[model samples]
Structures are given as C-alpha cells and as structure tokens.
Target: MQYPRKSYRIYFILLLIISCTGERSTNSKNNDSAAHNRTRYFYETVKATEDTREKIIYLDSALASIKNSRDTLLPLLLDYKIFYHNSLKEYDTSFFYVDSLISLSGAHRDTANLAKAFYRKARIYNYLGEQEEVFSNSFESRRYYLAAGDSSQAGRRTLEMALAQISGGDYLGSQETATEALSLLEQEKDSVYFSSVHNIIAQVYHERELYNDAVPEYRNALRFAPSLSDSLSILNNLALVYRDNKDFDKAIATWDEILGKADSKTKILRYEDNRAFTRWLKDSTQDVETELLDVLRLRQELDEEIGLQASYSHLLKYYLDKNEALSRKYSEELLKLTRKHKNAGMELTALQNLIPISPLPQTRSYFQRYIHLSDSLQMASINAKNFFAKIRFDEERKQEEIISLEAENRIQDLEAQRMRTRTLIGSLIALLLLLALSFLIYYLRQRFKREKIREVHKTESRISKVIHDELANDIFNVMSSLEAVAPAPVVDQLEKIYLRTRDISRENSDIETGENYITYLKAALTNITPRDSRLIISGETKVNWSRLQEEKKIVIYRVLQELLVNMKKHSGAKLVAVSFAENNKFVEINYSDNGRGLNWKRARKGSGLQNVENRLSSLNGKIEFESREGKGFRVKILIPS
Candidate 1:
C-alpha cells in the first residue's frame, strides 16, 4: 500500500521531538528508601512536563540528585543518563553508562537487571558501528533474559540478532533467526515485538529478492503497528518494494500516503520533487527539459532553505546537460554549501561539473580534486564492506558463548529442581515407616540421582565458563584490535589465528557439554573460513520449541553441534552442507564436510564421538558417518523430538 509522503515527514518530526525530551519518573523508582523516594519525585516532576525545555530541566535536576546520593543510586542515575545520551546520539557516553549498569548488576547478582544493561550496551554498540560487540552483548543479554524468566526480552534479542545478521548480508541466517523470534513473540502475544519480527521477516525476504513472500510480512507489520508513526517507515519500505516490482501506480499511491502525513515544509517539497521525477521517468515520451527544469527549481528552493549542497550540485548538472547558461551560478552555490557540509557526493558532483566548466588555468586542479575524492569514496566503500563482514563474524561467535552459558544455567536449575523432588519423596516416606521401607529405598535412590544431576551441572558450568569467560573474551579482543587497525588481508589471516584458538577452546568444552550440540557447532563454524565452512540447517515445518522437553531439544542441539565440530576439525575440502528432512514419523539431519572422509569401519571412536552416539541412542536415534580417503566426511543422524 502507498503511504503518503506527509507520513514520512511527520514521523521524523515526532522522532526528533522524542529525541529531544527526557525525564525521570518517581513511579519507576523501587521505593526502597527515602532517597529513592526523593529521586523518584524529582524524576516524575520533570517527566510530567510536556514542554521540552521543562523536561530537560527535570532530567538535569534528577541527574544531579542521583549523583549526590549514595552509591546505591548510581544504577538509577546511569539508567537515566543512558536514556538522555542515546536520545542525543552520545553513543560513547551511553555505552559507558550501560557498562557501568552491567557491572553493578553483576555485583548485585541481579541477572535480569544485568540482561537489560547488556541489551542497552548492544544497542549502543550498534549505533557506534561496532557490529561484533553488538552481537556479543545482545547474545549475553538474551541469555540473562532467559535466566530471569523474561521471555519477551529473550525474544526481542533474537529479533535483534536476526537484524544484525540481515545487515551483515547473511540472509539465510536471518531467515532462521527471524522464524525463531517470530514463534516466540506469537506465543507471548507481544504485538510490538511481533511486529518487529515480521518487519525482519520482510527484510529477509526483501534481501533475498523474494517479493512474493515479503508482501504478506510487510502487510503484517502494518497490521500490528497501530500507531501512525510506528507504521510509516515500513509503509515507505513497502512502497519501495512495489517500485521494485514495477507497480508504479501502487508505489505512487504509497508515496501519496507518506506525503499526506508529512509535517515538515522542507520534506514535503522534497517528496513532491521525488514524485514528479518518478512520474516523469515512468512516461516514455516525457519532455526531459521540462522535467529537468522542474527538478532544478525544486532543488534551488530547498537549497536556500536547508543549505542542501546536493540540490545545488543537482541543479548545476541539469543546467550543464541542457548546455544552458548560469551553470557558474549553481556551481558557486554548490561549492559554498559543500564547504559547510563537506558532503562527498555533492563535492564529487561539483568537481565533475567543474571539469567541463573550469577556466583554462584551473582545469588541472579540478581534475586532481575529482581524482582524490573518487579514491577516498572507493576506500570508504571497501571499509564499509569489511566492517560489515567483521560484524557478522563477531556476532556469530558471541551467539555461541551465550548458548553455552544458558545451557549451564539450565543444567543448574534442573539439578535444583531434582533435589527438591527427591526431598519431597523422602519426607513422604518418613511418615509411613515400615510400610514405606521400599519407598524409602526408592527415595534414597532418587537422592543419588539428584546428586548425579548436581555433578553434571558442575561439569557443564566449568565447560560453559571455558568458552564464555576465556575463549570469547580472547577472540573478542582480537576482533577489537583488528577493527582498530584495519589490517591487510595477510595480516587479517594472522589475526584470525586467535579466532582458531577460540574454536579449540570451545571444542574442549564440547567433550563435556555433549557431542553435536548447537552451541558447539555454531562456535566451530564461526572459527572456519567461508571457503571451508558449510552450513545446512533444516527443521520441521513448524517446530514447537517451547512444547518439546528440554532434554530432547538439548540432545538434538548437541548432535548437530558434534557433527559440525568434526566437519571443521577434519574437513579438508572447502564445502560443508547440512540438510534437514522430516517425514510424518521422524526428523532427519544430514551433515557433510568436504574434509577427509571418516571411515566408520576403520575409525577409532574417541570418547567425544562415542558420547554423541550414546546420547542419540538414548533418544532412539541412529547415527551414521560415511567418509572415504580423499572424500569428505558426512554424518547423518535421525531422531524424534
């Protein structure tokens, strides 16, 4: 559907207003102490004002109060600070506050609170262009959210991760992540988050050029976003999709709606110009001169109002194309405006125009300037691509660490619950003495079972820490340094050595976490090169993750993890592939690596490989590994969840 251009302009204006305002509300305070009470009061007073200036005053007052109070108030104060800093685009300051909140949450053993801090940190990292850090922090935040039983946040984190993947050009990965996040949001009845998930789904579809599928998802985003502001941007994007689909009428209708809601005079003018241009382009026999004149006039008007250098350059080009006089006037205006903004595109355009119009004495300087700007723009594009790749790589690695940590936490919770079950059984036996002697013996056995669980949890915790604390940190540090230095490809490969070391560390943990686990597999894959890494992920049409028993899910996760690990460890070939096929009765996973094929007949099964076999066996699953001397290894496992 076409959105009015007015909608787009109105949305930005509202966004600006929101960005400028701040407040601290007393209602949000814990109400635990007199100081908290006062702080809350001060906050609410500021927040109550609709006036932007008054709101700022309240924020400043609240901030001062928090700074003067006990150290206990630091988290509260920093939270507000983060809010304002983010609004102001002070990302560095915002991140510092988020980090402080995380540390405080850790000190207090507040897992849920810590998760929020981490989530904010991830958001800041995203804004700062630190894609890897954003992924890692977001993963950690999701882990903590799950730990805190905050399923909504957990689901949102998944959505955010999907966005990260999409932005990194991992469309397949994004599709999978979006599917998972959507399922969670649907279950939670979270309209806002559900809308976000749908938006990501649409984005993935769009990125993959699957317009047929994307259309429905975009419609879903509009359905859920009841607010005009919330839906406008997506509406604009949908219009773009229609434009891509060559549905000119539909695209124009969408733009019409955007124009309807536009609040700013400047934006409305720009929108009119775009619409006019699009319309002119669509008509085969349109008068080019008339169109050019219209566009040039629009640019001149906006240029004077907003100092838009691009418009000035555009006007200069249009005049030059017509071989008309007054090119010098536009050129001079573009140069003056470019001096203030230093906008590369406008500057480049101006330089190119100057190449043709320059006085005989200054032509060389114009050419040199053009060449220099072109090179800089080229370098910038290269840097952007590399930065995007690094973000994707880092995010995937961070996800592994988060999964491992969550697994350990889940093990501990299960152990605790088992202990309680045993205690209850024992107490019941105590009431019946002789008649319950058999029951008492069973109770004792259950206690032993619980103790076994505790032991297992302890082992898992150690392994989780190895990856979470030791390996993740080391690899992250390496990623950080690499980003800081922008090394050549050869140096980049050497830096990747640290990433390989991290893989080994995660692998070492896999021996205890169970073979073929998702976390282990993901970690192993992140360590390998794209040329060497193969990814195949498939599942049932609609797997009910929440309904499945935890142990069963973990088992499936582990099986896949182990298979991938072995692939990375042994696969000499550059290709890896995975496929999931399901029938009415069973789900099958096929993992293949183009490494030295494993010979099931001649291979000596290590403890880790054997353990994978055993876990699958417990689930009534069968495993097969087929590999020949020069071929790659392929492992197929079938199980029911």
Candidate 2:
C-alpha cells in the first residue's frame, strides 16, 4: 500500500528509536524466556516471509502490540525488514532503513550498529553495480567495525570492498584493500576470512592478467581454506586460473585432484568437463567431444543453467573451425542460455562466438546485436548508479534536516538547563551574603558592648584612685594636725570622716578578673549581709564563669555587690537569693529579694540603683524592680552571662 512521504519518515524514525532503545534494554535486562519467545515469534515471522510487501505487513502486525514498548527483538525485526527489501531488489526502501540505522546508532553512539548499517549500504551498492560507492561504503563499514574492535567483521568488510574495487578494474586499489583485510584477519586467526582475503588478492592479480603473480595468492587462499567445501572451491578456482594462464598440464592435474575429492555426481561431471576442456586446449588432436557433449546433456537434464552455459561455450569453441554448422548451433544454445539468465557477460561471450560463424548477410546483424547489447548494458549500469546516487543524496539531505532539528532541540534544552543552573547559583550566593551580613551585625554589637563595659571599668578605677591616693591622704594629714591642736570633738569628727573616705576607696577597688573572681564575689556578698537578713546563693557551681569575658565578669560582680549593699542599708528584707544557670545558648543569672518594697512607680532612682541599671544595659542584660509600699521590696535581675 502507498503512503504519504511524511508517514514513511515518521514510521522510520519511530522504528529506529524503538529498535536501539530496546536493543540496549535487552542486553542489560532481558532474561525472561517468555519475552525471548515473543521476540522469536515476530522475528521468525518477518524473516521467513520472502515477499517484501508481505514481510513488511507481517512486521507491522508483529509490531502492532509494540507501541512504545521496550520489545527485545526490535533489532531483529529491523534486520528482517532490510533483508526482505534487499532480496526483492528494493534498494531504495532498504537504503531507507539503513540510513535510519545509521542515525539511530549515531544518536546512541553505537559503534557496532553503525558498522552494520554501512555494511548493508555497501552490499546494496554492490547489487546496483556502483563499485565506487561500494568501495567507499565498505571502507566506512570497516573503519567503524575496527573502531568497535570487531576484527572479524572489519576484515570481512575490507575484503568485500577489495572485491568491489577489482570488479571496477581498480586492480592496485583492490590489492591494497585486500592486504589491509589480511592484516586485520591474521591477528584474529579467522581462517574463513583469512582465506577470503587471500582469494580477493588473487582475484585482483588475475583481473590484471598477472597469472604468475596470482599463483602464490591462490595457494595462500587454498592453504587457509577452513572447510572441505571451501578447499574444493579454492582448488576449482586455482585450476581455472591455471588454464587461463595457458598452464594446461597443471590445470588438468588440479582438476584430477578436484575429481578425486568430488563426492556428488554434479561435482564429478563439472570437474571432468573442465579437465577435458583443458586437455583439448593443450592438444587439439584429443577426442574430448564425447565427454564434453555428455557433460552438456547431463547438465541440461539436471536443469543446471550455469553448467549448461559453460558446456555450450566449450562445445562451440571446439567445433568452431572443424564443424561450422555445429559451432553455430552450440553458439545459439549458449546465447539462449545467456538470455534466459540475463547474464550480460555470458551473452557478450555468446555474441562474440556467433559473430565469426554467421553468414556474410547475417554477420553485420550479429555485430550490430553485439554492439547494441554492450551499449544497453553500459547505459543500464550508468542509470543504476545515477538512480542509487540520487536516492542517497536525497536521503542524506533529509538526514541533515533531521540532524539539524535534533541539534536545535538539544541546544534549546541545554540553554534551559543553563538558565536553571544560573538561577540556583544566584540563589545560593544571595543566601550566603545574607548570612555574612547577619554575622557582621552581631560582631559590631558585641564589640560595642565590650568597649562600653571597658569604659565603665576605667571610670570606676579613676574614682577609686582619687579617693585613696589624694582625698584620703589629705584627710589623714588634717586628722593628724587636729589630734595635736584642735578640740577633742572636732578631732574625733575628722577621724570618723577620714575612716569613711577610706571605706569609699575600698568599695571602688579593682576587681579580680580571673578564676578567683567568683570566690571574691561570694565573699563580698557574705561580708555585706546584715545580721538579721540571710543571703542565699544557688546554682553558682553550674555556671562556667571562666567562659564569660573579663569585663562582663567585673560588671556582674559589681552589680551583685550594689544590690546586696542596698538591701542591707534599706530593703530590711529577711532573705536574698542570687541564682546562676547555664544552657546550650547562654549563661543566665537571676537575682531576687523578699523585702519591704516601696511603690515602684513613685520611687525615685538613687545614684547607686541608677548605676546598677547603667551597668546591666552596657552588657546587653536586663533588670526589673518590683516593690510595694507595705509589701517586701523585690528586685529581679537578668544578666546574659
């Protein structure tokens, strides 16, 4: 059935994709016998069908259930399709599938499959008699197979290409290709292909009419022949070359060996005919007619068309001078056989035989017929080459278009992925910058707190030095003068004032900013506690006081002291508690008192209490005062230790 051109292309690509993907899946995971049997069913069905259209129909039917499936035998199905089309000489359709194989294999980078595709292309070109294309395509197949490390296939393709070159009369090129094939196969130790390469080289030499040069190659081919059938075939070829070289003795002797080895009647008759013909050529007086005629009759009876042509040519040559009418009769028989087979070479030989024997009136007609047949063959060969070339060119252009579209799609996909990657990178960079900014803010705030606390320490140190060094010294000197000259009440009052000045100096003294700091703080708190009020310190051992900064430690010590002093002087409370605790994130200290509390809103801030608020604020800590007129005066302090 006919279909639109687009439909065929679509179908081809679908098959190509399915086949390659399925082939890979099969290699990796197809172990089920049922799946293999299912594949076998389809593969055998299509392969067994000889008719091209019928095979394609069977292929379509088998593939009907294969829609978008990972069928394990897709490659087999494609192989049979190519096979059936090639058998029918439908090279265009065959080429279509081959190019699809190339595209699919290339898309997946399947080196072996690409070699197979080129091999099929070269074979089709061989059928079209386009030897140039055959050689080129075969070379490509060999190159790919070699790259895939398939030495046997590489050698086989090279030898086949060499044969193509020889057929096109490129003797030197054929010799070189054959030698390359030999090099490839020898390493593999493949006797079958090794012998084939030698045979190809021998043919190349024979085609140049260098019988002496061809002898050794043929011998080499015979030496490497792997099987009995192959050995006989090579022997028969060797004998033919010997006869063509006019070495009739050797040719007859070679045929004797062939006849001895022959197991079938057909083989015996063919060998006997060749031997008799060779002996007749060697000695024209020999009575070889009976044997030659008998071979011809037997071949005809057996309907062996090829053997009949050979027999007729032999008889015609033998009778050409002695019996004109008999020679003419044999030539006519040969011509009929050649015509039946449509073998242009055999027909040309037949026409050449008839030309010399025909009557004068018929001579020109026979010559004209020969010339016409030769020209028709030449024209047909040229036409076939051009036709196949045109198909290849058209297919290649379409292939290029398909490749361009696929490339464009791939570029688009890559661009999209790049865009996504860029976006993700940008997001990561932004998140990093945000984290860095947060860390910078935290560092600056901590630095500011530390500097502020240092300033408070420096101020307190200056005040303590002034009281002890300058003020207390002047008071002591005045008291010493009053003790000697002033009234007793005046001297006594000045002495008390000097003692209070010394007490203020001691209160503002430098703090111990070390491990002994907590001990010093506890002692100061206990020393200041009134006789009536009790001081309680809990959870102090739980705090890792050494981890806190020196300035923060000093501040904590001062604040606690101020609170205890105020409580002793004014609060008149029974109990005071200072608690410390450490958690995963922060160190915490809670100071609370149960004392007679004044109205918190109405209470004025004394210098000492205000000093406590300033100290806590500098360290990023918190404080709360809770008091009542008739209830206990309570102070709650929270310092981030």
Candidate 3:
C-alpha cells in the first residue's frame, strides 16, 4: 500500500504530461489501424495456391496499401512489384523493384535482399538474351550468397544459373555451373537441389551431342522426382534421347515401365504423351504400311491432331522413298489435319512432303499450296517479331517516363526558390536560346552528313550486287564449260585460272548477310558430291545463315562443301551424313562417309584436302579426321557459334 502511493503519484505526473502533449493519439492510432489492415491484406494475398494467382492478389493489396500509406510499407510494396514482374515475365521490371528495395533497406543491409536482386538481374539478362550480362549477374549473385555463407541456398541459385546457361546453348558453361552446384550440395544427398544438378548435367550432355552420357544423369533426376508428376515429361525426353542414340531397346523398356505405371485416372495429358512415344517406337522399322497403320491408330486414340499430322508428314516421306501405295492415304490425312489446324508452318511441311509423292498432275497444285503456306508463315513470324519489338519498346518508354518523373521532382526541389524569380527565368531563357541556336546548327550539319553517307552506301550496295550477280555468274559458267573439255596443258592452265577466279568470287561476295552461303554451298556440293546415291542432310536443314557471323559461317559452309566434294572424288561413299549442330561457343559440322577409309599419305597431295585445310585454318579451326583402312571416314569441324 505504501509503494502504490508513490507509483500512483509518478503515473499521475506522466499521464498529465502525455495529455498536455496529445500528439500521439491521432497519428499512432491511425498508423496502428493502417498496419492492422496491411497485415490482414498481406495474409489474404499470400494464401492462394497458385503462384501467379498469389502474385496477382499480392499486387492488388500492394496497390491498395500504396493508396492508404506508402511511406511506412515501401519495402513490401517493392516486393510486390518484383513478384508481379516475375509472374508476368517482365524481368527488367522485377530487377527495378529489387534495386529499389536494396536502396530503401538503408543501414539494415539485407544480404538476402541483395542476393535476390542479383538473381533477378541475372534472370532479366537471360530473358533479354544477353549472355555476358547473364553470367555477370549470376556470378555477382553467387558472390553475395557466398559472403552470406548460405551454401545450400547459393547452390540452388547456382543450379538455376546453370539452367540459364544451358538454355542459352552454353553447354560447357552449364557443365561448370552444374559441377559447382553439385559440389555445394554434395553433403545434402537427399536435397532436391542435388537432383537438379543431375538434370542440368544431362541437359549439357544432350546439347553437346553426348546422348549416351546424358542417360544416367536423366535417370538420376527421375529418381529424385519419383512421385512428382512433372518428372514424367523429363523421363520421356530422356527416353527419346536414348532412342536418338540408337539405344532403342532401353528406350522401349523405359517407356513400357512408364505405361505400366500410368493408370487411366492418372491424367489424359500424360497418357497422350506416352502414346506419342509408344507410336514412335512402333514405327522405327522399314515397313511403310505398318507405320502408316500405326500412325492412323494414334490419330484414332489421341486428341493430338497436330502430332498426327506430323506423323503423316513423316509417312509421306517414307512412302515417297518406298514408292508405296499408302502415300495417298497419309497425304489425304495430312490435308485433313492442315484444314483443321490452319497452321501455316505445318501446312507447308505437309504440302512439301506431299509434293514429291503426289501424282505428276497434282504436283503443281501442291507446290503452289506449299509456296502460299510458306509465305504466310514467314509473314506471321515477321509479325511476331514486330509484336515483341513493340512490347519491348513500350516497356522502355514506361521506364523512361519513371526516370523523367523522378528527375523532374529533383529539379523542382532544387529550383524551388529560383522558380519565383522573373529575373532568374529571363537569364535562363537567354541561355536556353543560345543553346537552341547551337543545337539547330549542329543538327543541320549532322543531317547533311548522314544523307551523304546514305547516298554513298546505296551506290556501293548497287555496284556490289551488280558485280556479284552478272560477272561472277558468267565467269563461273564459263569455268564449268571449260572443265568439261579434255585435260591438256592449256586446259590445266585454264582450270587453275577458273579455281583462282572462283576463290576471288567467294572472297569478294557478301559475308555479312550470308543468305547465299547455304544456297551456294548446296549448289557446289551437288556438283561435287556423288548424285547417284543416297545422301542425307538432316537436323534442321533450313538454317538461317544470317544468324551467323559472315566470315566464320562461310568458312564452315565452304568446309562442308569441300568435304562433300572430296567424298565424291575419293571416298566412293554411298551414304553421306552431314549434321549441323548450332550451339553456344561452337557450331560443329559432322560429316561422315560410308565409303572406303582414307589413306593419309595419299590424301596429302589432294587439292580437296588442301582446300579444306586452308579454309579451316582461316577460321582458326581444326578438322578431326577419323578413319581406318576399311570402315569409313568421319570429319568433325568445330568453330565459334
């Protein structure tokens, strides 16, 4: 009772002071209410099952909180922005939010926040297809993660970065990333991140054309994802890779295992996917009717109209090669599918396949159809590019607007006092007028200079095209005619002259666009490679040469052409296999011959050998020649992609 009297006296004095000040009741109460609302909203937004749906709700709550109070909850608002951009695949916007959060975090210095920022930046760079930027930011993220001493979390990010590298076609880079991740996750044997490392290694192997090496890694990934439904597709891809490596027995057995586990109630999509592989395995024989019937059965059971058309297209090629009566059956099926899908690309493929097999009278009609479809598809691709460009442009514009607004606010604050002065405004006006006059003069001069440059470029382009087309064509034709004449002293001299002229023509030709490289290579090889037998040019035959750097790609193209020519003249090979592997760091050419093995000593004096050596040397590449006395010849050439 005595202590209560003293405490009561102190409490009365404290309450009197608080009443006199009276500032906290309104502000603190409002803040508490706002915080309560925000907490409720945050929980409600985050409660969704789906990631994208949750992100949408988060964004809505964030926008609402901004309306109520932005200064107190800017950090969460920034997080919301990041989540929104990530969901929408707007990576740059996500990066901006991350950066904002880092700056706002102040003395707290959130390491996890910085890690996330760096990761987001890496992801953005990946989306923009900037390889250097992707690696740089990914490494930066790794550094931050390392500094934070979060090895497991760092390993997961490393795995994701490895996947980015893989998608960018950097197989070696991905392999390194995967190895690093594997080392980090080694202690955690049952960790999901460790499983990802295995999958990434498989992908890297797949990209490097080491399908055999990929099998076990994929199998390991499957083990980790055993009960997870997403693993099914990856298993299918692994099986297909096995099949590609001609391990069909294993592929079939694995697929059978997949089918056995697949119940009717599992999922329709999974069943359909399994059916595609099962059908593919069944058709891996040389029987056209049997394959066609299998394809027809697939069409009956599965709702994959597009896949059925693809099978039919393949069958069309098979029948044309076999001269089978079932050609018309597949062709009719293709026509039906094409009409249903109205997919220009698929329609063009079907028409092209049908063209060779259709009756002679029907050939022209199919050719016309093919041309129309191809043109439409090309136009659609162009439209898509334009659409993407427009979206990118709008994003850039929005970013610019935000930058300008912030700058404007800064400038307004700096000039807040000066803006009231008419004298200061007059002085600024005079300075601006002088600047404008100078800018006008500079602009006129630059415009004139650019116009002059344009004119010169146009003239050069015209002359180049004219010289390339008329003179080169006429000289090449004369050289062809002269080669047909019997070899003599003068004829040999003339042939040397022809070879020199051809070399000059190729060197002087356009390397930048290189649109004619593949076409010219095709023509040159056709003239040189034996036409009397089967030669297969597989693996995305219609590659856009413009995607390559002119000089290097031309070197590869010419090298392949020379290889084919040598094969025709010397190898006596019946089957020629030419493979084009487009990848990051290197584009490889695999040319194999089923002809007699090469004699290195004899080949030393060959002109074709000399030509290949010269071309490969110019491109800073080397040829790996594989041949025994009797088996066959295989030449692998690698160059920077």
Candidate 4:
C-alpha cells in the first residue's frame, strides 16, 4: 500500500528533525566531556608545587590530555608552562611558551589570562636583566589587568614595576611607582601588598642613604606585614638600615629581636653577622672577628654567595689592622663574589676596602681602579636621575594637554549638540512650511479641476442643445426646402451640417472604456484626419493601450483631436504622422503634420492649445509642441500608466 503524498512529507520532516536532534545531542555531550577534561587538567597542574621540573611534568601531562582542545584553558596551560620554564631559567624555552600563550590568549581575547601571561613574561625578563623588556612587559600587563578590571592584580604589578625601577637605579622613579602602588592598594585594603610596597619604598630610600626617610617606610612595612616571616624579614632590613645610619643601639636591639624570632640556623647566623658588624662599628676593641668568621663559614657551607659576600666584607674590616694576610684574602674574596653577582655597588665598596691595605704599587693601582669605577657609577646614577626627571616632566605635560583637550572636546560636543538641535528645529519648520504649501497647492488644484469639470459640463450641455434645437433643425429645413429641386451644393451643405452636429455630440460625450476604449480612440483620430492628408501612423499597435486608465485615454484622445483639427483648419499641408510607444512607467505619443508651421510664440497664447495642455495636466501628463515657420508641426505627449 502506498502512503498519501502529505503523509510522506510529514514522515520525512519527522526523520529530519530526529536526525538533527540526535546530532545536536551528540555534539553537546562531546563538548561537555572536553570541558570537563580541560578543567580537571588545569586544577591538577595548578595544585602542584613550585618545583620547576615537577611543574613542567604536570603541565606537559595536562597538555597531552587536552592536545586536541583549542580552548581558553589551552592558553592558561601554556602560561603555566612559561612560568615553570622561567623559574628553571630555561629562557629560550620560556620565551617560546610566552609566544604561544600570547598568541592563544590574544586570539581568544582572554584578557585576564593575557595579563597574567605578560606579567610572567615580565618576571622572566627581570631575571634575565633585560631592563627595557621588563618595563615594557610590566606596563603591558598592568594595562591589560586594568582593562580586565582586575585592579588588585594591577596594583601588585605596580609594586613589581617599582622594584624593577629600583634595580635599574631609578630611585626616584621607583619611589613614585611605589607611592602609586600604595595608593592603589590602600583603596583595596590589601595588607600583604601594602607591606610589599612599603618595603620596596624603604629599600629605595635606604639605597639613596636617606636613612631618616627609610626608617618610617620600614616601620610602615612592619606594621602592615601579613605574616610572621614577612615581619621578620622587614625587621631584618630595618636593623640593617639602623646599622648603616650608625644608630648602634637601635641596630643591636633590632638584631636581638630578629635573633629571638628567627627559627632557622641560617636566619640566626645572618642576624649574628649583622649584630657583630654593628658592635665593631661602635667599639673597634670588641671581639667581632671570631663572630664574623663563624658567619662566613656558615654562609660558605650553605653556598649562599650573597651572604658570603657580606660576611667576607665584615671579616676583612675586622682584620684590617691585626692580620694583613687574612684581611687581603677576605677583600679578594669579597671582590670576586661581588663581580660574580654583578653587584656594582658592592664591588665599589670592596675596591675601596682593598685600596688602603695594599702595598705602594698595588695600592696605587687599586686606588685608580676605584676612582674609575666610582666615576662611572656616579655618571650612571646622574643619567638615571635625568631620565626619571624627563619622564616626570613629560607625564606632567601630558596631563595638562589631556586636560586642555578634554575642555575643548566638551565645548565641541556642546556646539555639535546645539547644531543638531538647530538643524532639527529647522527641519521641522521646513517640513511644516512644505506641508502648508502642499495643502495650498492641493486646494487650488482641486478647485481648478472642479471648475474645468463644470466648464466641460456646460459646454457639453450647450453643444447638445445646439445640435438638437438649432443645427438639426436647420439641416432638416434645408433638406426639406431642396428636396425636389435641391442643387448639389445645397444638398452637400445640409449633409455637412448633419455630420458636424454629430461630431460635436461625440466630442462632448462620456468616454467608452476598457477593451473597446482603444478602438474608440483610433476611430476618433481617423475621423479627424482630413481625407486629403497623408496619415503615417507607427508604434500604435506596439503600445499596450489596454493597460492605460480610461481617463488617461480620454485625455490623449482629446489632445490628438485638437491637434488634428488645428492642422486641418490652419495648416494646408497633407502629411500627418502619429506614433505610440510605452516604457515601464509611461506611454509616449508622437504626432506630426506637414503643414504651415505655427508661430511658436503666438501658439502658446491660444486658448484651444491651453485647453489641451490643461486636459493633459489633469491626468498628470505632459505635452511638448515643436513648430517653426515653414516646417512641420510636431507634438509629443507622455502619460503615466
């Protein structure tokens, strides 16, 4: 049995709907599974420790797990890989990961992830000592963080930026950045970041030897420190600042506090070394040499090069008078360590320590080296200060310019708004005026149309009366009078009178429309053409006359009749041509006659031609007349379909 056609269509539609639903369900399940896997891998890697190798293993495994998924999580994983490689100091591998993270995050418009990625890149660059790259990437990260509305992250990055500036010897710039970071973090009330910012500021002042400025900043850092360990670290730095300022009492007290709180042997050794130095400064006769040597041995065992440098410097200072060999050995060791660490400030200090202790020639050589290094360092510091001053000046100028631009823009906006308001008002007024003019024109047009109709009615009535009462009666009377002995001229005159009366009646009658309207129009034209005239008609059959409205056809019929009549009565020539054609929107009619051409100016003043123009105007049509002395007359008419 065959199914009905409607049933077949319904069955086919049901099959398509089920197929589409099944396909969508399968895709949704796949997407969900992929999302779950990505989330699982990300969590697994994030929970891993900071061991670079271990982090790399986890990240590699996670990447393998989601190798086919190109989602937001992919960039996040790549960012973690960059951080791990950077921690391992594998710079080339780290940069590769950085590039990958940037590409993926940028492509996905993951602003938060991109910000974190740039921040990691900045940290790596900082470690590589690429000062420009560090500054640029940090700025980029801060901008992206702000754009992502992660203000807390942006504040933290600002602190990192301050630290970077400090490392680059831009102490003033560092101080400014630290203050900015402080302002941002204060709004957030982030105690940890606040502590960090204060610490950085204090370090900057301390480096500049502004111990008075540094003391308050360190106190602030201590007050805001979030953890015991962080507080201890700040206290240690505070103690060092006191020692540098020669406040031996405060320095010893701070070190005692650090020693009491410090849990590890390394911390105890560090504070001990610092306290020993402060004691030696206070009284050179104190037994600080053994304590310094003990600190040096401990630092060497721990392989802490930085701590060893500090220990060696203190030991050399202590042994300067008592043991020349040990003093020189410690100085050499300090210089070597400072150079290895690329600490120019410490190297300068070490050179100064060595110069006075060496023999005549060696002392002279050391003194010269010291002077050269000092001058270079001084010049660098001066340049850094100048650079920071220029930066501040430019920033201030930019702020002023921005303020000026904002004022100008506000004025422009107001002016534009006023112009818009004026334009709108002008447009409304113009529109109202146009409507009033249109109403007046329409009123006049309707009034004129009514008057024309009334005139046509009156003419029709008068013509009908004349035909019935006067012309018909005269024709009959003449016919009766010459019935038996009628001359040919009298008989012809009577027949002419009858035909003229009939033609007048037809001209004034209502139009025949529809299928037979074209035939009526053709007959009217043929009747008006004189028998002697050579009528050449073209394009008449080509026109779609059936599409034309009845009123339009009547107007065309009247205009053509008027033209033909005028041609026969005034012009004695024979040839007359008429053509009709149509376009998409209009029908065009061309009529010409070889006749005594009209006086162009006088013809425009004639009432009969004006009536023809009025009739065409009522139908929204136009007519053009071409005539010159001794040339054929031509008329072109266009009527909307």
Q: Estimate each model's TM-score.
A: 0.44, 0.66, 0.39, 0.60
User: Tens-digit lDDT track for model 3 on 258-361?
Assistant: 66565443233344444454445467453335645565566658666766776676666566645556766777778878888665556676677677767887
Give the candidate order by descending TM-score: 2, 4, 1, 3
After superposing candidate 4 on the true structure, give the runs of residues whose Cα lies further than 4 Å from its correct spot.
1-70, 186-189, 321-323, 379-427, 446-641
Model 1 vs truth, CA RMSD: 42.1
- Candidate 3 off by > 4 Å: 1-77, 84-99, 102-108, 120-140, 186-190, 226-231, 263-320, 323-641
Per-residue lDDT of candidate 1, residues 120-193 (tens digit): 88888787766556666777888888888877778888888877766555566667777877765644367887
Best by TM-score: 2
Write the number of the candidate with greater TM-score, choosing between 1 and 2: 2
> Which residue pairs show backbone clashes in model 2?
595-632, 595-633, 596-632, 596-633, 597-632, 597-633
Clash list (residue pairs), candidate 3: none
- Cα deviation of 508 in candidate 2 (Å)? 3.1
Residue-pair clash count for candidate 4: 0
Task: Let me know the TM-score candidate 3 reaches against the reference structure.
Answer: 0.39
The candidate, 2 or 3, that scores higher on lDDT is 2
> lDDT of candidate 1 vs native?
0.66
Model 2 residue 424 CA deviation (Å) reads 15
